[model samples]
Target: MQSKNQLVELPLFAEKQVTLVLKREDLLHPFISGNKYRKLKYNLLEANNSGHGTILTFGGAFSNHIEATSFAAKEKGFKSIGIIRGEELVDSWHKNTTLLKAHEDGMKFKFVSRDDYRRKEDSDFLADLTKEFGEFYLVPEGGTNTLAIKGCEEIITEDDKQFNFICSSVGTGGTVSGLINSSFPHQEVLGFSSLKGDFLKKDIDKLTNNIRWNLISDYHFGGYAKISQELIHFINEFKKYTNIPLDPIYTGKMMFGLFDMVRRDTFAKGTKVLAIHTGGLQGIAGMNSVLKKKKLPLLDI
Candidate 1:
Protein backbone atom coordinates (compact mmCIF):
# COMPACT_ATOMS: atom_id res chain seq x y z
CA MET A 1 0.00 0.00 0.00
CA GLN A 2 2.87 2.41 0.86
CA SER A 3 4.72 1.87 -2.40
CA LYS A 4 2.25 4.09 -4.22
CA ASN A 5 3.50 7.38 -2.74
CA GLN A 6 6.62 9.57 -2.82
CA LEU A 7 8.38 11.73 -0.21
CA VAL A 8 8.63 15.48 -0.80
CA GLU A 9 10.30 18.13 1.41
CA LEU A 10 8.78 21.54 2.13
CA PRO A 11 11.28 24.38 2.61
CA LEU A 12 10.11 26.56 5.49
CA PHE A 13 11.23 29.20 8.07
CA ALA A 14 11.93 32.19 5.82
CA GLU A 15 14.05 29.90 3.65
CA LYS A 16 16.87 30.82 6.00
CA GLN A 17 18.78 28.70 8.50
CA VAL A 18 15.93 26.15 8.83
CA THR A 19 13.86 24.00 6.52
CA LEU A 20 11.12 21.46 7.25
CA VAL A 21 10.48 18.43 5.10
CA LEU A 22 7.01 16.98 5.03
CA LYS A 23 7.04 13.22 5.04
CA ARG A 24 4.10 13.25 2.66
CA GLU A 25 2.14 10.30 3.99
CA ASP A 26 -0.89 12.22 2.69
CA LEU A 27 -0.47 10.89 -0.84
CA LEU A 28 -0.34 7.25 0.19
CA HIS A 29 -3.99 6.42 -0.43
CA PRO A 30 -6.49 8.52 -2.37
CA PHE A 31 -9.60 7.13 -0.69
CA ILE A 32 -7.95 7.09 2.79
CA SER A 33 -4.62 8.88 2.81
CA GLY A 34 -1.71 9.92 5.09
CA ASN A 35 -0.56 8.30 8.32
CA LYS A 36 -3.88 6.47 8.44
CA TYR A 37 -2.48 4.10 5.82
CA ARG A 38 0.76 3.30 7.64
CA LYS A 39 -1.03 2.87 10.96
CA LEU A 40 -3.58 0.44 9.55
CA LYS A 41 -1.39 -1.55 7.14
CA TYR A 42 -0.02 -3.97 9.68
CA ASN A 43 -3.34 -4.31 11.50
CA LEU A 44 -5.05 -5.10 8.24
CA LEU A 45 -2.37 -7.65 7.49
CA GLU A 46 -2.89 -9.13 10.94
CA ALA A 47 -6.62 -9.29 10.36
CA ASN A 48 -6.01 -11.05 7.08
CA ASN A 49 -3.45 -13.25 8.82
CA SER A 50 -5.91 -14.20 11.53
CA GLY A 51 -8.54 -14.97 8.93
CA HIS A 52 -10.96 -12.56 10.58
CA GLY A 53 -13.82 -11.44 8.39
CA THR A 54 -14.19 -8.05 10.11
CA ILE A 55 -12.29 -5.29 11.92
CA LEU A 56 -13.72 -3.40 14.91
CA THR A 57 -12.57 0.01 16.13
CA PHE A 58 -13.70 3.33 17.64
CA GLY A 59 -13.72 6.97 16.54
CA GLY A 60 -15.73 10.19 16.45
CA ALA A 61 -18.30 11.33 13.87
CA PHE A 62 -15.64 12.83 11.56
CA SER A 63 -12.81 10.52 12.42
CA ASN A 64 -10.26 9.92 9.64
CA HIS A 65 -9.21 6.63 11.17
CA ILE A 66 -12.76 5.34 11.13
CA GLU A 67 -13.19 6.41 7.53
CA ALA A 68 -9.87 4.98 6.39
CA THR A 69 -10.28 1.75 8.31
CA SER A 70 -13.71 1.30 6.80
CA PHE A 71 -12.53 1.60 3.18
CA ALA A 72 -9.41 -0.45 3.88
CA ALA A 73 -11.44 -3.29 5.41
CA LYS A 74 -13.90 -3.49 2.56
CA GLU A 75 -11.13 -3.24 -0.04
CA LYS A 76 -9.42 -6.21 1.58
CA GLY A 77 -12.57 -8.29 1.86
CA PHE A 78 -13.10 -7.67 5.60
CA LYS A 79 -15.99 -5.88 7.29
CA SER A 80 -15.63 -2.87 9.66
CA ILE A 81 -17.34 -1.67 12.81
CA GLY A 82 -16.86 1.94 13.95
CA ILE A 83 -17.90 2.65 17.56
CA ILE A 84 -18.73 6.31 17.45
CA ARG A 85 -18.65 8.58 20.50
CA GLY A 86 -21.25 11.12 21.62
CA GLU A 87 -24.93 10.48 22.27
CA GLU A 88 -26.57 13.29 20.36
CA LEU A 89 -27.93 12.59 16.91
CA VAL A 90 -26.35 14.56 14.12
CA ASP A 91 -28.75 16.58 11.95
CA SER A 92 -28.35 13.98 9.25
CA TRP A 93 -26.50 10.68 8.97
CA HIS A 94 -25.64 11.77 5.44
CA LYS A 95 -23.88 14.93 6.72
CA ASN A 96 -20.37 13.44 6.27
CA THR A 97 -19.50 12.03 2.84
CA THR A 98 -16.54 10.04 4.17
CA LEU A 99 -18.66 8.25 6.76
CA LEU A 100 -21.36 7.70 4.18
CA LYS A 101 -18.79 6.17 1.83
CA ALA A 102 -17.58 3.97 4.68
CA HIS A 103 -21.17 2.75 5.10
CA GLU A 104 -21.28 1.98 1.40
CA ASP A 105 -17.94 0.22 1.85
CA GLY A 106 -19.61 -2.15 4.31
CA MET A 107 -18.99 -0.49 7.67
CA LYS A 108 -21.30 -1.38 10.52
CA PHE A 109 -21.43 1.65 12.79
CA LYS A 110 -22.46 1.45 16.44
CA PHE A 111 -23.04 4.79 18.11
CA VAL A 112 -22.53 4.81 21.87
CA SER A 113 -23.52 7.34 24.51
CA ARG A 114 -21.02 10.02 25.55
CA ASP A 115 -20.71 8.38 28.98
CA ASP A 116 -19.94 4.92 27.59
CA TYR A 117 -17.22 6.23 25.27
CA ARG A 118 -15.45 7.95 28.18
CA ARG A 119 -14.89 4.55 29.80
CA LYS A 120 -13.32 3.16 26.62
CA GLU A 121 -10.14 2.15 28.43
CA ASP A 122 -11.76 -0.24 30.84
CA SER A 123 -11.68 -3.99 30.20
CA ASP A 124 -15.45 -4.01 30.42
CA PHE A 125 -15.58 -1.91 27.26
CA LEU A 126 -13.66 -4.51 25.26
CA ALA A 127 -15.62 -7.34 26.84
CA ASP A 128 -18.89 -5.70 25.92
CA LEU A 129 -17.78 -4.91 22.39
CA THR A 130 -16.40 -8.40 21.89
CA LYS A 131 -19.61 -9.96 23.13
CA GLU A 132 -21.57 -7.74 20.80
CA PHE A 133 -19.41 -8.40 17.73
CA GLY A 134 -18.20 -11.96 18.26
CA GLU A 135 -14.56 -12.98 17.47
CA PHE A 136 -13.37 -10.11 15.31
CA TYR A 137 -10.03 -8.32 15.13
CA LEU A 138 -10.02 -5.35 17.49
CA VAL A 139 -8.25 -2.08 16.66
CA PRO A 140 -8.23 0.46 19.49
CA GLU A 141 -9.36 4.02 19.09
CA GLY A 142 -7.03 6.00 16.77
CA GLY A 143 -5.55 2.67 15.67
CA THR A 144 -2.71 3.05 18.20
CA ASN A 145 -1.87 -0.59 18.49
CA THR A 146 1.72 -1.88 18.68
CA LEU A 147 1.40 -3.12 15.14
CA ALA A 148 0.40 0.37 13.98
CA ILE A 149 3.32 1.99 15.76
CA LYS A 150 5.70 -0.50 14.23
CA GLY A 151 4.37 0.51 10.84
CA CYS A 152 4.40 4.26 11.58
CA GLU A 153 7.99 3.89 12.70
CA GLU A 154 8.86 3.40 9.04
CA ILE A 155 8.58 7.17 8.54
CA ILE A 156 11.97 7.59 10.17
CA THR A 157 13.61 4.52 8.59
CA GLU A 158 12.78 5.80 5.10
CA ASP A 159 16.09 7.48 4.33
CA ASP A 160 19.28 8.76 5.98
CA LYS A 161 18.18 12.30 6.71
CA GLN A 162 19.67 13.49 9.98
CA PHE A 163 17.17 16.12 10.95
CA ASN A 164 17.73 18.01 14.17
CA PHE A 165 14.02 18.00 15.01
CA ILE A 166 11.00 15.91 13.97
CA CYS A 167 7.41 16.91 14.64
CA SER A 168 3.96 15.39 14.15
CA SER A 169 0.43 15.92 15.42
CA VAL A 170 -0.52 14.16 18.64
CA GLY A 171 -3.95 12.64 18.10
CA THR A 172 -3.30 9.18 19.60
CA GLY A 173 0.54 9.51 19.76
CA GLY A 174 1.03 6.44 17.62
CA THR A 175 2.82 8.48 14.95
CA VAL A 176 4.89 10.50 17.42
CA SER A 177 5.82 7.46 19.47
CA GLY A 178 6.74 5.48 16.39
CA LEU A 179 8.87 8.27 14.90
CA ILE A 180 10.66 8.85 18.20
CA ASN A 181 11.38 5.18 18.67
CA SER A 182 12.72 4.97 15.11
CA SER A 183 15.03 7.98 15.37
CA PHE A 184 18.60 8.34 16.50
CA PRO A 185 19.03 8.50 20.29
CA HIS A 186 19.96 12.22 20.21
CA GLN A 187 17.33 13.48 17.76
CA GLU A 188 14.32 15.25 19.32
CA VAL A 189 10.64 14.97 18.49
CA LEU A 190 8.09 17.71 19.25
CA GLY A 191 4.46 16.61 19.13
CA PHE A 192 2.06 19.50 18.62
CA SER A 193 -1.44 18.82 19.91
CA SER A 194 -4.76 19.99 18.50
CA LEU A 195 -6.45 18.69 21.63
CA LYS A 196 -6.34 21.10 24.57
CA GLY A 197 -4.99 20.68 28.13
CA ASP A 198 -2.54 18.26 29.77
CA PHE A 199 -4.82 15.23 29.36
CA LEU A 200 -3.46 14.38 25.88
CA LYS A 201 0.17 14.77 26.94
CA LYS A 202 -0.28 12.38 29.84
CA ASP A 203 -1.97 9.84 27.62
CA ILE A 204 0.85 9.95 25.03
CA ASP A 205 3.54 9.79 27.71
CA LYS A 206 1.89 6.79 29.36
CA LEU A 207 1.69 5.00 26.05
CA THR A 208 5.41 5.63 25.53
CA ASN A 209 7.57 3.03 27.24
CA ASN A 210 11.21 3.20 26.04
CA ILE A 211 11.34 6.60 24.31
CA ARG A 212 11.52 10.11 25.78
CA TRP A 213 10.66 13.29 23.80
CA ASN A 214 9.34 16.87 23.95
CA LEU A 215 5.85 18.40 23.71
CA ILE A 216 4.80 22.00 22.98
CA SER A 217 1.77 23.33 24.91
CA ASP A 218 0.79 26.51 23.04
CA TYR A 219 -0.96 24.97 19.99
CA HIS A 220 -4.47 23.21 20.11
CA PHE A 221 -6.48 26.16 18.62
CA GLY A 222 -9.43 25.70 21.02
CA GLY A 223 -9.20 21.87 21.07
CA TYR A 224 -9.89 19.03 18.71
CA ALA A 225 -12.41 19.64 15.85
CA LYS A 226 -12.28 23.31 16.83
CA ILE A 227 -11.00 25.94 14.37
CA SER A 228 -10.56 29.68 14.01
CA GLN A 229 -10.81 32.05 11.04
CA GLU A 230 -7.08 32.71 11.33
CA LEU A 231 -6.43 29.00 10.84
CA ILE A 232 -8.79 28.76 7.84
CA HIS A 233 -7.04 31.70 6.22
CA PHE A 234 -3.71 30.13 6.97
CA ILE A 235 -4.88 26.94 5.30
CA ASN A 236 -5.95 28.96 2.27
CA GLU A 237 -2.72 30.94 1.87
CA PHE A 238 -0.80 27.76 2.49
CA LYS A 239 -2.50 26.09 -0.45
CA LYS A 240 -2.04 29.15 -2.67
CA TYR A 241 1.70 29.24 -2.00
CA THR A 242 2.53 25.54 -1.82
CA ASN A 243 -0.24 23.86 -3.80
CA ILE A 244 -0.42 21.17 -1.13
CA PRO A 245 -3.78 20.53 0.52
CA LEU A 246 -3.61 20.64 4.33
CA ASP A 247 -6.58 19.30 6.22
CA PRO A 248 -7.68 21.84 8.83
CA ILE A 249 -8.56 19.36 11.54
CA TYR A 250 -5.07 18.09 12.43
CA THR A 251 -2.16 18.93 10.12
CA GLY A 252 -3.22 22.58 9.74
CA LYS A 253 -2.76 23.25 13.45
CA MET A 254 0.59 21.53 13.40
CA MET A 255 1.72 23.66 10.44
CA PHE A 256 0.38 26.82 12.10
CA GLY A 257 2.28 26.12 15.30
CA LEU A 258 5.35 25.03 13.40
CA PHE A 259 5.39 28.26 11.39
CA ASP A 260 5.02 30.31 14.57
CA MET A 261 7.88 28.47 16.23
CA VAL A 262 10.03 28.78 13.14
CA ARG A 263 9.50 32.54 13.01
CA ARG A 264 10.59 32.71 16.62
CA ASP A 265 13.91 30.97 15.75
CA THR A 266 12.98 27.81 17.64
CA PHE A 267 15.91 25.88 16.17
CA ALA A 268 19.48 26.96 15.62
CA LYS A 269 21.03 27.68 12.22
CA GLY A 270 21.31 24.75 9.77
CA THR A 271 18.86 22.74 11.87
CA LYS A 272 16.92 20.38 9.62
CA VAL A 273 13.38 19.37 10.59
CA LEU A 274 10.66 16.94 9.50
CA ALA A 275 6.91 16.97 10.00
CA ILE A 276 4.46 14.18 9.22
CA HIS A 277 1.41 14.90 7.06
CA THR A 278 -1.08 12.67 8.81
CA GLY A 279 -3.78 13.31 6.21
CA GLY A 280 -7.29 14.52 6.99
CA LEU A 281 -8.05 15.80 3.48
CA GLN A 282 -11.60 14.51 3.55
CA GLY A 283 -12.37 17.41 5.87
CA ILE A 284 -11.68 19.73 2.94
CA ALA A 285 -15.15 19.03 1.50
CA GLY A 286 -16.49 21.35 4.20
CA MET A 287 -13.75 23.95 3.81
CA ASN A 288 -15.57 25.95 1.19
CA SER A 289 -18.74 25.88 3.27
CA VAL A 290 -16.89 27.11 6.35
CA LEU A 291 -15.08 29.91 4.53
CA LYS A 292 -18.29 31.05 2.85
CA LYS A 293 -20.21 30.92 6.13
CA LYS A 294 -17.61 33.31 7.57
CA LYS A 295 -17.66 35.42 4.37
CA LEU A 296 -13.97 34.83 3.86
CA PRO A 297 -12.49 35.39 0.41
CA LEU A 298 -12.63 32.43 -1.93
CA LEU A 299 -9.48 30.77 -3.26
CA ASP A 300 -11.09 28.23 -5.55
CA ILE A 301 -12.11 30.85 -8.10
Candidate 2:
Protein backbone atom coordinates (compact mmCIF):
# COMPACT_ATOMS: atom_id res chain seq x y z
CA MET A 1 0.00 0.00 0.00
CA GLN A 2 1.15 3.54 -0.73
CA SER A 3 1.61 5.50 2.49
CA LYS A 4 0.90 9.20 2.73
CA ASN A 5 3.74 11.66 3.18
CA GLN A 6 2.84 13.86 6.13
CA LEU A 7 4.47 17.27 6.30
CA VAL A 8 6.38 17.80 9.52
CA GLU A 9 5.79 21.41 10.62
CA LEU A 10 8.70 21.70 13.01
CA PRO A 11 10.23 25.12 13.77
CA LEU A 12 13.63 23.69 12.89
CA PHE A 13 12.54 23.01 9.29
CA ALA A 14 11.10 26.51 9.02
CA GLU A 15 14.28 28.07 10.44
CA LYS A 16 16.52 26.07 8.09
CA GLN A 17 14.36 26.86 5.03
CA VAL A 18 14.07 23.14 4.33
CA THR A 19 10.99 20.99 4.01
CA LEU A 20 10.77 17.75 5.99
CA VAL A 21 7.98 15.33 5.19
CA LEU A 22 7.67 11.94 6.84
CA LYS A 23 6.48 9.05 4.69
CA ARG A 24 4.15 7.44 7.17
CA GLU A 25 4.94 3.82 6.50
CA ASP A 26 4.36 3.30 10.20
CA LEU A 27 0.63 3.54 9.50
CA LEU A 28 0.80 0.67 7.00
CA HIS A 29 -0.46 -1.87 9.54
CA PRO A 30 -0.83 -2.31 13.28
CA PHE A 31 1.46 -5.36 13.38
CA ILE A 32 3.07 -5.73 9.95
CA SER A 33 3.82 -2.05 9.61
CA GLY A 34 6.42 -0.10 7.61
CA ASN A 35 9.53 -1.85 6.26
CA LYS A 36 8.65 -5.14 7.85
CA TYR A 37 5.58 -5.30 5.64
CA ARG A 38 7.64 -4.36 2.58
CA LYS A 39 10.33 -6.88 3.44
CA LEU A 40 7.91 -9.78 4.03
CA LYS A 41 5.39 -9.34 1.20
CA TYR A 42 7.06 -11.41 -1.50
CA ASN A 43 8.80 -13.75 0.92
CA LEU A 44 5.41 -14.89 2.24
CA LEU A 45 4.13 -15.33 -1.31
CA GLU A 46 7.15 -17.47 -2.17
CA ALA A 47 6.64 -19.66 0.87
CA ASN A 48 3.00 -20.27 -0.02
CA ASN A 49 3.79 -21.06 -3.65
CA SER A 50 6.62 -23.39 -2.67
CA GLY A 51 4.29 -25.58 -0.60
CA HIS A 52 5.92 -24.66 2.69
CA GLY A 53 3.65 -25.13 5.71
CA THR A 54 5.94 -23.43 8.20
CA ILE A 55 7.92 -20.15 8.20
CA LEU A 56 11.08 -19.83 10.30
CA THR A 57 13.17 -16.74 10.98
CA PHE A 58 15.66 -15.31 13.46
CA GLY A 59 15.68 -12.17 15.60
CA GLY A 60 16.39 -10.64 19.00
CA ALA A 61 13.84 -10.54 21.83
CA PHE A 62 12.13 -7.33 20.68
CA SER A 63 12.69 -7.66 16.96
CA ASN A 64 9.98 -6.17 14.76
CA HIS A 65 10.74 -8.84 12.16
CA ILE A 66 9.96 -11.66 14.58
CA GLU A 67 6.66 -10.08 15.64
CA ALA A 68 5.58 -9.13 12.12
CA THR A 69 6.50 -12.51 10.64
CA SER A 70 4.47 -14.31 13.24
CA PHE A 71 1.35 -12.26 12.56
CA ALA A 72 1.71 -12.50 8.77
CA ALA A 73 2.28 -16.25 8.85
CA LYS A 74 -0.77 -16.75 11.02
CA GLU A 75 -2.90 -14.65 8.71
CA LYS A 76 -1.65 -16.63 5.69
CA GLY A 77 -2.17 -20.07 7.27
CA PHE A 78 1.49 -20.90 7.89
CA LYS A 79 2.98 -22.13 11.14
CA SER A 80 5.64 -19.72 12.41
CA ILE A 81 8.84 -20.51 14.29
CA GLY A 82 11.09 -17.82 15.69
CA ILE A 83 14.73 -18.76 16.27
CA ILE A 84 15.26 -16.18 18.95
CA ARG A 85 18.63 -14.99 20.19
CA GLY A 86 19.25 -14.82 23.96
CA GLU A 87 18.61 -18.16 25.58
CA GLU A 88 18.21 -16.21 28.78
CA LEU A 89 14.72 -15.33 27.61
CA VAL A 90 13.69 -18.97 27.32
CA ASP A 91 11.83 -18.64 30.61
CA SER A 92 11.24 -14.89 30.66
CA TRP A 93 9.80 -14.52 27.16
CA HIS A 94 6.30 -13.95 28.45
CA LYS A 95 7.36 -10.74 30.12
CA ASN A 96 8.34 -9.13 26.82
CA THR A 97 5.38 -7.53 25.09
CA THR A 98 6.76 -8.19 21.59
CA LEU A 99 7.42 -11.87 22.23
CA LEU A 100 4.14 -12.30 24.05
CA LYS A 101 2.21 -10.85 21.14
CA ALA A 102 4.06 -13.07 18.67
CA HIS A 103 3.33 -16.09 20.83
CA GLU A 104 -0.33 -15.16 20.89
CA ASP A 105 -0.22 -14.96 17.11
CA GLY A 106 0.83 -18.62 16.98
CA MET A 107 4.61 -18.43 16.91
CA LYS A 108 6.67 -21.11 18.60
CA PHE A 109 10.04 -19.97 19.89
CA LYS A 110 13.39 -21.78 19.99
CA PHE A 111 15.78 -19.78 22.11
CA VAL A 112 19.51 -20.11 21.54
CA SER A 113 22.63 -18.57 23.01
CA ARG A 114 24.09 -15.43 21.38
CA ASP A 115 26.97 -17.45 19.90
CA ASP A 116 24.71 -20.10 18.39
CA TYR A 117 22.49 -17.36 17.02
CA ARG A 118 25.52 -15.87 15.25
CA ARG A 119 25.86 -19.15 13.35
CA LYS A 120 22.33 -18.73 12.01
CA GLU A 121 23.60 -18.64 8.42
CA ASP A 122 25.88 -21.66 8.69
CA SER A 123 24.93 -24.77 6.71
CA ASP A 124 25.27 -26.98 9.78
CA PHE A 125 22.86 -24.81 11.72
CA LEU A 126 20.25 -25.09 9.00
CA ALA A 127 20.71 -28.85 8.87
CA ASP A 128 20.13 -29.12 12.60
CA LEU A 129 17.03 -26.95 12.46
CA THR A 130 15.76 -29.00 9.51
CA LYS A 131 16.07 -32.21 11.49
CA GLU A 132 14.12 -30.70 14.38
CA PHE A 133 11.46 -28.55 12.70
CA GLY A 134 11.21 -30.40 9.38
CA GLU A 135 11.20 -28.46 6.12
CA PHE A 136 10.32 -24.76 6.34
CA TYR A 137 10.84 -21.56 4.41
CA LEU A 138 13.79 -19.73 5.91
CA VAL A 139 13.41 -15.95 6.04
CA PRO A 140 16.70 -14.36 6.97
CA GLU A 141 17.01 -12.13 9.99
CA GLY A 142 15.27 -8.75 9.52
CA GLY A 143 13.34 -10.48 6.71
CA THR A 144 15.76 -9.13 4.09
CA ASN A 145 16.48 -10.99 0.87
CA THR A 146 16.18 -10.56 -2.89
CA LEU A 147 12.40 -10.74 -2.72
CA ALA A 148 12.37 -8.37 0.24
CA ILE A 149 14.49 -5.85 -1.66
CA LYS A 150 12.15 -6.19 -4.63
CA GLY A 151 9.24 -5.37 -2.36
CA CYS A 152 11.06 -2.47 -0.74
CA GLU A 153 11.83 -0.98 -4.15
CA GLU A 154 8.12 -0.42 -4.47
CA ILE A 155 8.28 1.94 -1.45
CA ILE A 156 9.55 4.76 -3.64
CA THR A 157 6.82 5.56 -6.12
CA GLU A 158 6.74 8.24 -8.82
CA ASP A 159 5.38 10.70 -6.25
CA ASP A 160 8.57 10.40 -4.19
CA LYS A 161 10.73 11.79 -7.02
CA GLN A 162 10.10 15.35 -5.90
CA PHE A 163 12.28 14.97 -2.83
CA ASN A 164 15.96 15.94 -2.97
CA PHE A 165 16.90 13.38 -0.32
CA ILE A 166 15.43 10.06 0.80
CA CYS A 167 16.20 8.94 4.34
CA SER A 168 15.55 5.62 6.09
CA SER A 169 16.64 3.71 9.18
CA VAL A 170 19.04 0.89 8.33
CA GLY A 171 18.82 -2.46 10.05
CA THR A 172 19.51 -5.29 7.58
CA GLY A 173 20.39 -2.87 4.68
CA GLY A 174 17.69 -4.26 2.37
CA THR A 175 15.36 -1.29 2.77
CA VAL A 176 18.02 1.34 2.07
CA SER A 177 19.44 -0.72 -0.79
CA GLY A 178 16.02 -0.80 -2.41
CA LEU A 179 15.68 2.95 -1.93
CA ILE A 180 19.07 3.47 -3.59
CA ASN A 181 18.19 1.27 -6.56
CA SER A 182 14.91 3.06 -7.17
CA SER A 183 15.90 6.63 -6.24
CA PHE A 184 16.29 9.37 -8.81
CA PRO A 185 19.90 10.02 -9.87
CA HIS A 186 19.79 13.53 -8.51
CA GLN A 187 18.35 12.47 -5.19
CA GLU A 188 20.73 11.32 -2.47
CA VAL A 189 19.66 8.38 -0.28
CA LEU A 190 20.86 8.47 3.31
CA GLY A 191 20.78 5.47 5.65
CA PHE A 192 20.91 6.10 9.40
CA SER A 193 22.33 2.91 10.80
CA SER A 194 20.71 1.44 13.89
CA LEU A 195 23.77 -0.70 14.39
CA LYS A 196 27.10 0.63 15.65
CA GLY A 197 29.54 -0.15 12.81
CA ASP A 198 29.96 0.55 9.11
CA PHE A 199 29.58 -3.13 8.24
CA LEU A 200 26.15 -2.55 6.66
CA LYS A 201 27.75 -0.59 3.80
CA LYS A 202 29.17 -3.84 2.42
CA ASP A 203 25.87 -5.63 2.85
CA ILE A 204 23.99 -2.85 1.07
CA ASP A 205 26.67 -2.64 -1.67
CA LYS A 206 26.06 -6.31 -2.42
CA LEU A 207 22.43 -5.49 -3.21
CA THR A 208 22.77 -2.33 -5.33
CA ASN A 209 25.41 -0.69 -7.55
CA ASN A 210 23.85 2.77 -7.27
CA ILE A 211 26.30 5.33 -5.84
CA ARG A 212 23.57 7.77 -4.79
CA TRP A 213 23.53 6.44 -1.26
CA ASN A 214 25.52 7.00 1.93
CA LEU A 215 25.35 5.34 5.37
CA ILE A 216 25.47 7.65 8.41
CA SER A 217 26.97 5.80 11.38
CA ASP A 218 26.99 8.46 14.10
CA TYR A 219 23.53 8.13 15.76
CA HIS A 220 23.29 4.53 16.95
CA PHE A 221 23.21 5.82 20.59
CA GLY A 222 25.39 2.86 21.60
CA GLY A 223 24.55 -0.12 19.40
CA TYR A 224 21.67 -2.31 18.36
CA ALA A 225 18.83 -2.27 20.95
CA LYS A 226 20.63 0.40 22.93
CA ILE A 227 18.96 3.61 24.16
CA SER A 228 19.61 6.59 26.41
CA GLN A 229 17.63 9.26 28.27
CA GLU A 230 18.32 11.90 25.63
CA LEU A 231 16.80 9.67 22.97
CA ILE A 232 13.79 8.90 25.14
CA HIS A 233 13.23 12.59 25.79
CA PHE A 234 13.48 13.39 22.09
CA ILE A 235 11.05 10.63 21.12
CA ASN A 236 8.52 11.81 23.66
CA GLU A 237 8.91 15.42 22.59
CA PHE A 238 8.67 14.52 18.91
CA LYS A 239 5.45 12.67 19.50
CA LYS A 240 4.13 15.57 21.53
CA TYR A 241 4.92 18.12 18.81
CA THR A 242 4.19 16.08 15.69
CA ASN A 243 1.70 13.55 17.08
CA ILE A 244 3.94 10.89 15.54
CA PRO A 245 5.24 8.15 17.80
CA LEU A 246 8.75 6.81 17.12
CA ASP A 247 10.31 3.67 18.49
CA PRO A 248 13.50 3.84 20.50
CA ILE A 249 15.59 1.73 18.17
CA TYR A 250 15.52 2.34 14.44
CA THR A 251 13.19 5.18 13.49
CA GLY A 252 13.91 7.37 16.53
CA LYS A 253 17.65 7.31 15.92
CA MET A 254 17.13 8.04 12.23
CA MET A 255 14.83 10.98 12.99
CA PHE A 256 17.20 12.31 15.66
CA GLY A 257 20.13 12.16 13.28
CA LEU A 258 18.11 13.71 10.47
CA PHE A 259 17.05 16.63 12.67
CA ASP A 260 20.57 17.08 14.00
CA MET A 261 21.95 17.20 10.48
CA VAL A 262 19.39 19.84 9.61
CA ARG A 263 20.44 21.82 12.68
CA ARG A 264 24.06 21.57 11.46
CA ASP A 265 23.02 22.90 8.03
CA THR A 266 23.92 19.64 6.33
CA PHE A 267 21.25 20.18 3.69
CA ALA A 268 21.09 23.22 1.47
CA LYS A 269 18.27 25.70 1.86
CA GLY A 270 15.10 24.82 -0.10
CA THR A 271 16.00 21.09 0.05
CA LYS A 272 13.09 18.71 0.35
CA VAL A 273 13.70 15.70 2.59
CA LEU A 274 11.58 12.60 2.97
CA ALA A 275 12.37 10.59 6.07
CA ILE A 276 10.82 7.14 5.88
CA HIS A 277 9.06 6.05 9.06
CA THR A 278 9.94 2.36 9.10
CA GLY A 279 7.71 1.09 11.91
CA GLY A 280 9.00 -0.58 15.01
CA LEU A 281 6.42 1.06 17.25
CA GLN A 282 5.58 -2.33 18.70
CA GLY A 283 8.95 -2.36 20.44
CA ILE A 284 8.25 0.78 22.47
CA ALA A 285 6.43 -1.05 25.23
CA GLY A 286 9.29 -3.50 25.65
CA MET A 287 11.81 -0.68 25.52
CA ASN A 288 9.86 1.22 28.14
CA SER A 289 10.00 -1.84 30.34
CA VAL A 290 13.77 -1.84 30.06
CA LEU A 291 13.88 1.88 30.76
CA LYS A 292 11.89 1.40 33.96
CA LYS A 293 14.39 -1.18 35.16
CA LYS A 294 17.23 1.22 34.49
CA LYS A 295 15.38 4.08 36.20
CA LEU A 296 15.60 6.07 32.98
CA PRO A 297 13.03 8.26 31.27
CA LEU A 298 10.32 6.34 29.46
CA LEU A 299 9.11 6.77 25.88
CA ASP A 300 5.61 8.14 25.80
CA ILE A 301 3.22 5.90 23.96
Off by over 4 Å in 1: 1-15, 158-160, 209-212, 286-301
Lowest lDDT 10-mer window, candidate 1? 1-10
Model 1 steric clash pairs: none
Candidate 2 lDDT over 43-99, as tens digits, reads: 999999999999999999989999999999999999999999998998899989999
* Local accuracy of candidate 1 as per-residue lDDT tens digits, 110-168: 87898898877788888888888887898888899789888888877546357777888
Where does candidate 2 have its weakest 10-residue lDDT segment? Answer: 288-297
Off by over 4 Å in 2: none
Over all chains combined, what TM-score does candidate 2 have? 0.99
TM-score versus the correct structure, for each prediction: 0.89, 0.99
TM-score of 1: 0.89
lDDT, residue 263, model 1: 77
